[model samples]
Target: MTLFTVDPATVTPAPFTDDDWAFTLLRCLASPSTEEYPPARLCGFLFLAPDRLRLYFGTEPDLPGTTAADVRPGGALTALLAALPSLLDEQRLTKTDTDDPHCSRVVDLTGW
Candidate 1:
């Protein structure tokens, strides 16, 4: 698993509310990447605390590994998020079907 710690102060508009945090997260995850290859697929949980936010990426259902800049909030964070989804694609990782119930349950829950 990979953990990304974000400093709230650096995030523009500063996520002060639950809704704001959700929106910021979605926006970052949906932002466009500046890469020519596809981004990696991220499957994990997001933990929001009173002081900061944590993005925990798991290595199941999909391969791991992602590249990011300094990840300063705002633009840099968005770029990093956008780049994650295309990592596996860029590496030409193949998606295989699984029969494990636990794995299937995870995939179903995450809709990955």
Candidate 2:
């Protein structure tokens, strides 16, 4: 068998306050199939901010869309690690990136 290793620089380091959002997202992407929800195949990108956390998945994911209540059971990762259950519960299921909200401003905390 061949072995491969990941370079540290390519990874997004977890913030000190929480365990690790990246790992949590990975787990959600690998969830096992269940009666209500099928196994997660492809996990969409993660958009994180102080006040909001959003997950975007396309229709090809084999998951249902947002319900009439404008709420759906978000991936387990957001619920478990985010801690802001209500705010993080909403996800944008879209197939195209054109509809995604553009980042007008970004703060660099790398030096902090």
> Which candidate has the top score in lDDT?
1
User: Candidate 1: worst 10 consecutive residues by lDDT?
Assistant: 103-112
The sequence of per-residue lDDT tens digits that candidate 1 reaches over residues 16-88 is 6654654576554544354443233233333334423333334433543322211223333444454544442
TM-score of each candidate structure, all chains considered together: 0.29, 0.29
Q: How many backbone clashes are present in model 1?
A: 8
- Model 2, residue 104: what's the lDDT? 16
Error of 1 at 107 (Å): 23
> Mind giving the per-residue lDDT tens digits that candidate 2 earns over 1-112?
9999999999999644332544454465456434554322333434354323333332233334421111123334444433322222234422222333532112221111
Task: Give the Cα error of residue 8 in candidate 1, in Å.
Answer: 29
Q: Residue 109 error for model 2, in Å?
A: 26
How high is the lDDT of residue 86 in model 2?
26
